[model samples]
Target: MKFVTFSHKKAGHHHHAGVLDGEQVACLTEAGLAASVLEIVQGAKSALDKIRGGLTQAPRYALADVTLEAPIRPGKVLCSGINYKGHAEENPNAKMPTEPFFFAKLPSSVVGPDVPVEKPVRSEQMDYEVEFTAVIGKPLHKASEFDVMAAIFGYTLLNDISARDVQFKDSQITIGKNFAGFAPIGPCIVTADELTRPDDVALKTRLNGKLLQNGSTSDWLFSLPRLISFLSHYVPLEPGDLVSTGTPAGVGAFQKPQIFMKAGDVVEIEAAGIGVLRTPIVAG
Candidate 1:
């Protein structure tokens, strides 16, 4: 099942949890099943069973009648860095890490599909990275790889928008990656049972209709189990916490002449089976 958080056009600005069935969405809130995606995540299997059994009776809305929001408001947006071999190889300065190199993007930075991401006046080299993100379903601390697999709730996509100038000048990554609207996530979260091949999913990024980054999870240097387990040992992940696997190559800063997003440009990121997450660039 594809789970979503959305606001109906005629229903004011309130957000609701929903299940998507092609072009139609069954409103879980309207059906009295769940109030938010975080509730469903924490409830685990019982909540899922309820959503599946009562789907037919839920209020339905057309895709065009509502706006999609990030699937969940996670407590932490944990991200892996240089986990893709191609991405590591592309950057002359990057040394392949023996362990998962992780970072955090503020939850406030998150926006939904079709939202506009601001090109902050402080940056000149804005870039795009499409990552496959996992949503944790249960708690984990010093977990085994096998346990990590069982703890996954679903999969979603995240665009790691960065400000290269700020990143390099400040000599840090967090501030550059945490601008407002920088972490655009979701069209919907495809439940783990629905995405059987999470390790081999394909990913792509297009800047203004031109395909720039084309790679797959098959190229990942660290597998999902390896990454999650490593993180759990220190972070003590909880339900609704996100684990965003890093991107493959083709970021703008590495290009020969360099390329950066400006106002009016749209960036579309696609993760096979999960659907496209589109973000428009706007002046800060």
Candidate 2:
């Protein structure tokens, strides 16, 4: 099932979860089932089933009538660094780590679909990383592969926007990655059971309609289960936590001529089964 959190201009900017159908949404709030997407996610499998049930009688709104928000403001936004094999190979000079190295993004950095991401003035090199983000459905601590897989609620599309100069120059990558609207996630979240082969999902990155990145989860050096298991080994992952499974090989930083984002550029990330996430780049 595809779940969304959206708001309409006529109703203001707060977001609420809903079941997305053809072009309309059956909202959980209007149906009196849940308060927010996070609440549903925290409820785990039962919450999803409730939304599905509500769809039969919930008030319907055109999907185009509302603004989509990032599925949830995850309690912790964890990310894997260069976990894709080709992505690792692309940066030949920087030796790739064997284990799952990670980074974090603050909640403030997230933006929903259609919102504009600023091209921060502090950096000359702004790049895009199309990521497949896993949303945790159940709390986990030192979980195994089977347990980690069970904990996954679904996956969504995310553009891991980066200010490269700030990243390389700073001791920690947070500042570079946490600029306002740096992360654009969601059109909808595709539940884990919806996909027949989650491991072989396709993903891509496009800049102004030009396809720049095309790869699949099949090429990932560290698969989703491994990422969750590894992270759970060190930190307690709660329901509603978001884990971005790194990007493919085509980020602009490693390109021969080095292309960077500029104001007016439109970025798009498409992950099969999951929806596309688009964001406009504007000057900060």
Candidate 3:
């Protein structure tokens, strides 16, 4: 099922978790289920099954009437770097990581679909990384592949809006990738069972209607199970902790002449199973 968090103008900015059926949104609350997406996720499978059943008879609204938020309000956003072979080849300066290399984004950095991703005036080299992000459902530590597979809640798209200058200049990338609106993720989260192989999904990134990056999880340097198991070894896998599989090659920074995003540009990250994550760019 495709689960989402949305808000309508009539309800103000306060968001409600619901399921998107075609162009309609079935609000979970209408069926007596909890309205908070985060709360539902933390409750795990039993909670989701209830929500799924509720969706069948829930009151629905046109999707356009409500604004979409990041599918879940995650506690931490952990990302992999240069995990795609093509992306790693594009940057000859950095070595291909032998193990999962991760970074974190603060929870506040998140925004919803169609939101404006502000380009801070302080940096003129902001870039984008379209990733296949996974949400953890069950807690785990040093988990096995079987364990990791069962722990996955679902998959979604995340545009890891990056500030290239700071990312390359500073040794640490967390800050450069943590700018407000830098982590725009959602439309909806397709539960793991809905997809046959999350690691084999196709992904594409378009900027202002021009396709820039296109690749599939089949090209991943490290698989999803390895990423989750690696992360679980250090941190307990919580229900809402987001773990994003890294982007493919076509990042603007590695091009003949860098192609960073500018004001008034529109960016879309689309993936199979999950839908598009549309974000507009504007000056800070």
Candidate 4:
């Protein structure tokens, strides 16, 4: 089932966990199944079971009558950097890492579909990267790869917006990728059970109607299970923590003339099985 966090147009301030059914939404919160998407993740299987059982009776709304929000505000936004061989190959100076290399994007940086990603005026080199992000369903620490595979709840899309100037200036990438609207995460989360062959999903990114990045998880240098297990060895991953697999090769910085998003540009990130996550660009 596709899970979402949404708010009715008439009551825009309140967001609720929901199950999307075609052009309609089954409101889990109204049915008392969940308070928020984070709560559903925390509750894990039990919450999902409740949602399934109560779905038929839950309050419903037309998909167009509600506004979608980031599926969940994860406690941690752990991102893999250069985990794609093609992506690493694009940078003459970047060599593939033998082990997973990670970075953190502040959770507050996350925004939902159609929101505007502000291009900070302080930097002129803003870029976009579409990452296949996984959401943790169970807590894990120093777990084996098998355990990591079982712990995955689902998958979603994350646009790793970056300020290239700031990122290249510092050895650390956190600040460059943590601007308030930098991480646009979801339209919905496609539960793991519904997707097969997580490693083979196709990913694409388009900027202002031009397809700039197109690749697949098959190019990953580090697989999802390995990436998650590697992270779990150092930090405990909670149910709502996000582990974003790295982007593919076509980022603007690696382009011949280089491409940076300017005001009024729209970018879309699409992951097969999941939907497109679109964000508009505006000056900060």
Candidate 5:
């Protein structure tokens, strides 16, 4: 089942639920059949079954009439750096860590599909990083590869928008990636069961209709399971925690004549199985 969080036109409130028939959404409300995305995710199988069984009698709203929000309210945003071989090679100066290199992005950085990515005026080099993000379904601590596999809830598209100038200006990447609208995630979350092999999905990025990045998960130096296991050892991953698996090469910084986003540009990130995450670039 495809799950989503969206805002209704009349109420202007964010709601979560299973998408029905591409045209309608089954809103989850405490007073009604469903209450929250967390509740549905914790009991996905049963929630899906309930949605399917209630289809004939369920009340749903037209998809076009509502605004979509980030599918999950992530407790933390864990990002991997230089996990892609080509991306690491593009920045030869970057010291590739022996183990998975990770960082945290504040949850406030998240915005949903169709939202505008504000290009900070202070930085002239705004770039895009296409990544596949996995949502954790269960709490995990010191998890093994097997535990990591079982903990995954689903996959989603994430555009890790960065401010190149700000990123390299400082020793750390925190400022570059922590801008107000730096992270654009989701059209909706695709269940893990739908993906035959989550680790093998292809990811691509486009800027204003031009394809810029194309790579597969197979190119990852530290696989998802390994990253998950490694992170679990340091901190407990709770339900709705997001882990962005990293981006491939072809970022603006790597280009021969580096190109950055300008006002009115559209950036799109797509991952196989998971849908496209498209956002417009607007001046801050």
Candidate 6:
């Protein structure tokens, strides 16, 4: 069953089960279901059973009449860099790290679909990275491949927007990835069971209706299982933790002329089964 965090036109806010062919949303509380998406994820089997039962009797609000929020309140956001072969090749001088290169984005950077991607006035070279993000369902420490596979709750589309000028100027990438609204995380999270093969989905990015980056998860140099196993070896991963798998090669910085985002541009990131995340670029 699909789940969401939404605010009805009349009611202030709450979590709900997305239903009725995507036209309606049923409040989990009113339906006597789990209180939050985290609760559902923690008790997925029982929660799903309850949501399904509620579908038969709970009243639902029109989808158009509610505002949607990020499906999960991530405890931490981990992002991989140059994890795609082609993407690594795009910058010949930069050697691929022997281990998975990772960075963190503050949870405050996340925004839902349709939210504006505020352009920080301090930077002019903002760019986008389209990637698939994994949402963790269970706490894992030094997890094995099997444990990692079992711990995945779902997948979602992620736009790793970067402030290139600041990114390169500093030795670290944190400055580039941590700007407010830099992380556009969701249209909605697609549960693992809903996907045929979560690790093989196709992903792409578009700028103002023009396709820019097009690639598949099959191109990942470090697969999800490896990433999870490797990361858990260092730090523990908790429920709702997010790991963005990395982007393909067509980023603006790699273009011959180098194209960066400007005000009023719409950026869209899409991954098969995970849905699309669209946001407008505007002055900060």
Q: How do the predictions measure up, each by TM-score? A: 0.98, 0.96, 0.96, 0.98, 0.92, 0.94
lDDT of 3 by residue, 1-284 (tens): 88899887756566787888899988886567867877877888889878766667887889878888777889888988879999999997979889999888788999889989889887889898899999888888889877888888888888999888887885758878888999998989888889869878889999999999999998899999998898889988788889999999899898877799999999999998887889999989
Number of clashes recorded per candidate: 0, 0, 0, 0, 0, 0
What is the TM-score of candidate 4?
Answer: 0.98
Residue 99 displacement (Å), model 3 = 1.0
RMSD of each: 0.9, 1.4, 1.3, 1.1, 2.0, 1.7
Better of 1 and 4 by lDDT: 1
Q: What lDDT is obtained when candidate 4 is compared to the true structure? A: 0.91
lDDT against the true structure, per candidate, is: 0.93, 0.85, 0.86, 0.91, 0.82, 0.82
> What is candidate 5's CA lDDT for residue 256?
85
Task: Score candidate 2 by TM-score against the native.
Answer: 0.96
Off by over 4 Å in 2: 9-14
The digit string of per-residue lDDT tens for model 1 on 111-150 reads 9999988899988899999999999999999999999888
Q: Model 3 compared with the native: what TM-score?
A: 0.96
**Candidate 6 at 283: error in angstroms?**
0.8
* Top candidate (lDDT): 1
Span of 10 residues, lowest total lDDT, candidate 6: 12-21
How displaced is residue 208 in candidate 2, in Å? Answer: 0.8
Provide the global lDDT of candidate 1 against the true structure.
0.93
Model 2: per-residue lDDT, tens digit, 136-240?
A: 999899999878888888888878898888988845498988889888889888888887576798999999999999999888888788899999989899988
Off by over 4 Å in 6: 13-20
lDDT for each residue of candidate 5 in 79-157, tens digit (9 for 90 to 100): 9988988998898588776999888888999998889878898889999999888888888899998878878888887
- Which numbered prediction scores highest in TM-score against the true structure? 1
